[model samples]
Target: MLVFELVCNGTVNDILHGGNKAPLKLDLRLIIAAESAQGLAYLHSQAHMKIWHGSFQPANILLDQNFMPKIAGFGISRLITEDKEHTCNVIGDLSYMDPVYLETGLLTLKSDVYSFGVVILELISRNKPTHSVNNRLVRRFLEVHKEGKKATELFDKEIAVTMADLEILDCLAVIAVECLNLDVDQRPTMTDVAERLLMLNRSRRSQAV
Candidate 1:
């Protein structure tokens, strides 16, 4: 028999909008980002076989009563070998697909990193991967970033951000940018991304106290 734990809080996708529920708080968003990054890091590094989550996104991330994130939907993940070239036809939400992967059909660890970057931006902006205002969130984000605009300008209205919290938001934005680099080699590994987020979350909590 198989049993599944009930995720009382629903998914990251739901929490973002929080239709009837309370919108995701900034601190909770940080915690969710850190936990999701750790979940991806484990799948990419510590698993018996390195699993590449070809379809990582907000909807696939389940949240518990305490808002802790658990990554789901491994049914489509690719099990890759160290020496094996893990390449396949592109399959995933187009809004979050890595340009390099979409064009080359070469799925790599960096591809997941790129997708995670989109999720990060989504969490920060409370915008879908492709919004009506901007067809592609990542491209729009990069464009605004290149124009020397602050990440605070893009922050979701529901998330309360004071002057003090801007630095933390900026740090997360920088990490997201690294993950979304067009050049696959420039992206950081999931482990690195996870650790960086964890540290930032801790710092934010410390400052809140």
Candidate 2:
């Protein structure tokens, strides 16, 4: 028999948009990002039966007493059997849903990567879900990235204190941009994403030490 503990910190959505302006610690947020990426990596690759987190969003990531993230919403996820890659279902939050999946009902591994990218952007900017199909938050950042500018103006003022943090944040933005790439073939796998994030976490920690 298996049991799960209740999360006190609730979902990432709760902490970010829970009608409170109080800041979540940058260090903990970095940890959450790494852990969440690890969890997604497991689901995507290591699970006995490969699972697709059909609805990967901030609202589905729960935090425990340690503020460690546990992904929710597997109940709605589809299992990948053999070499099958997609299901004919249009499921996911509009804000974080992959545009290709929304249109073609072809949910691939890259689809979840796209959603994870949005969550990364949200963490950096503390932005909420954009109900509109045209996401201004994602678009503006991409534009800034294309211009090779740091776009420090878009970083959340509360957490953008140190030069190190800004540099780390810029790298995350670059990763997010890659994840949000229009060509699904160009996006990195969740394993690649998790490794990159873990490297970033380690790099940040080394700097603090």
Candidate 3:
């Protein structure tokens, strides 16, 4: 039997739920989100057989001692055999589920993209996607942006002070908006999203240095 090393930092969900001594900082959250996107990019592109992470959520994502993100739980993954319909009715976490996939049984790459968008929202808002009080976070964020509200106000209080780059935050928010588009066909491919995020991450690092 083969064994894998345990990740030290634990799930992103845990850290968000006061698991850590202090709240996660802004740069750290962005880094983790970017890393998670890279992981998804690899899984979507490098595999000989396409694997759909069926369930991509903060709880399903793990972090290492270095705070690197790793996607786990492939047990529910559906290997795309052909362009045919998959009869499996796998339902992921409700909050992170793609609305299109929820209505239709078809699971596609875009489904993962939608779930990733939710994760991005969570990182920005520091709130759970399924929070009953504010379930339509993405919609509200977009509304607030359109209304000329300060975008930084949407971010968690912990990292509010460090959020100087409103442009970058706006870009990220726009990307998330595209990802969460109601029409799956309108969403950017994981490859495209990964490349864009990689550039963003590099830019952020350069600015930090």
Candidate 4:
């Protein structure tokens, strides 16, 4: 059996809910989102075959001592193969399940994209999908964005912010919205999201320096 080193910092969900009095900093969330996207991109873009991480939720995301996100839980993973009989009866978390997959019982790369979109939304909204009441939350979020509402309002209240960081926060919110598009075909690929997030991370780091 292969053994992996223990991550001292626990999971992303634990840190988010530990009542540390200080929530995760906006910059840290950005970095986490970017890193998570990179991992998903790698899984999806493998030249030999694509791997679908059926359960990609915050609880499955472990954090190292440095607070970096490492995606876990490949027990339900499925490889795209020529076998048509290999249908995935098991779906991801209710909050993260792609609507199409729920209806069709077919596991595709788009299902992973949909789940990643939910994770992105959860990161920005600081709300668990199980806690969310309606499907309209994403729609309402986009509507608010269109109406020029202050995007920082979407962040967790415990997180402190400066006026200078508002623009970056807004950009992050917009990206999250893009990921949550109801139509999977309309949503950006994990690879595209990863690249964009990488650019954003670099831009922020340059500005900080």
Q: Per-residue lDDT of 1-209 in model 4, one digit per residue for the tens?
A: 99997798888777766667245777888899899999998988954667777778888889898988899988667444535414557545777776676767776666777777777767767776762345554655677878978666666654436654676667777777777666778888889989988998888898889
lDDT of 2 at 64: 93
**Could you give candidate 3's per-residue lDDT for residues 1-209 as a string of tens digits?**
99987898888988887545466777788888788888888887887866788788998889888888889976557454437445357466878887777777777778899999888888877877763434677667767757867567777766666546555676677788789888888999888888888888788788889
The TM-score-based order of candidates, best leading, equals 2, 1, 3, 4
- The TM-score that candidate 4 achieves is 0.85
> Which runs of model 2 end up more than 4 angstroms from their true locations?
1-3, 79-89
Task: Please provide, for model 1 over 104-135, each residue's C-alpha lDDT reduced to its tens digit, 9 standing for 90 to 100.
Answer: 87777788899899999998888887633334
Work out how many backbone clashes candidate 1 has: 0
lDDT of 2: 0.86
Against the reference, the lDDT scores of all candidates come to 0.82, 0.86, 0.78, 0.74
Q: Tell me each candidate's TM-score.
A: 0.91, 0.93, 0.88, 0.85
The better-scoring model by TM-score among 2 and 3 is 2
lDDT, candidate 1, residue 16? 75
lDDT by residue (99-201, candidate 2, tens digit) is 8888887777788899999999999989875858579888889899999898699888888899988998888898899999989999999999999999999
lDDT winner between candidates 2 and 3: 2
Model 2 / residue 159 / CA error / Å: 0.7
Q: Per-prediction RMSD in angstroms? A: 2.3, 1.8, 2.4, 2.7
Model 4 spans > 4 angstroms off? 19-22, 79-90, 131-133, 136-139, 146-150
- Superposed by TM-score, candidate 4 places the C-alpha of residue 53 at a distance from the truth, in angstroms, of 1.1
Question: For model 4, what is the error of residue 96's alpha carbon versus the real structure, in angstroms, after optimal superposition?
Answer: 1.4
